[model samples]
Target: MSSTANWSYTAQATIWRCLGRNEDGILTFDRPVVIKCDYGMNARKGSLDIGRECVIKNTIWTEYGKASVGDYLLIGKSSEADPISAGAEEIIHIQRFADTFERNADDYALFTGGD
Candidate 1:
């Protein structure tokens, strides 16, 4: 059986791959790629909170090798859409794991981000 057979990847997102900065010290990204994954968001209390704009606690679980830190993620967006115009989320941290017997799934990457 496939390891990911029971996995629930219910969300769709676009990944803007980072391609290093330019001479002007501006980060650049390649074209976006659409992917399926499990997505979640939470509101946290902190000094950064302002009105209803609390800290965004975002979490995403997807196949390994899909994305990394510095890459941008636009949840509910597609590759053909403009990420900047649609509000893209930055990937701050990534936790990768290999499949295990208890959690029978393919190697996966967990992306956490939001300000």
Candidate 2:
């Protein structure tokens, strides 16, 4: 593990819980979702980058060399392109590209997950 007060890593992580405060109080809810991605921040520049398929809405917490809470994705443990989180669960995959490509000459598409 390279330690410079900043580092980068990828892992297959499961969304264990979604914490929120209701009338009762703070609580943890079920949000079992898994994702594989490449994510990290450039400590020097204070810049962060997420993979094409990884959509990070928010980061909950970071502890024990891992993020404890948040709705985000990060690089998986496998360096290979093979996806790690594969199963019957519903999953949405996102891929980013430099430019749009002609799908069938009749249509154009952008890989940025947006119109």
Instruction: Give the number of the best model, judged by lDDT.
Output: 1
Judge candidate 2 at residue 71 and give its lDDT.
Answer: 22
For model 1, residues 4-101, the per-residue Cα lDDT tens digits are 62456757778888788899997778888877777777445323223333344577777636677678887775755445555787776676776556
Clashing pairs in 2: 10-75, 10-76, 11-75, 11-76, 11-77, 37-74, 37-75, 38-75, 60-69, 60-70
> Which window of 10 residues has the lowest lDDT sum in candidate 1?
45-54
* TM-score of each prediction: 0.69, 0.27
Lowest-lDDT window of 10 residues in candidate 2? 106-115
Error of 1 at 49 (Å): 22
For residue 74, give model 2's deviation from the true position in Å.
Answer: 7.3
Per-model C-alpha RMSD:
5.2, 15.3
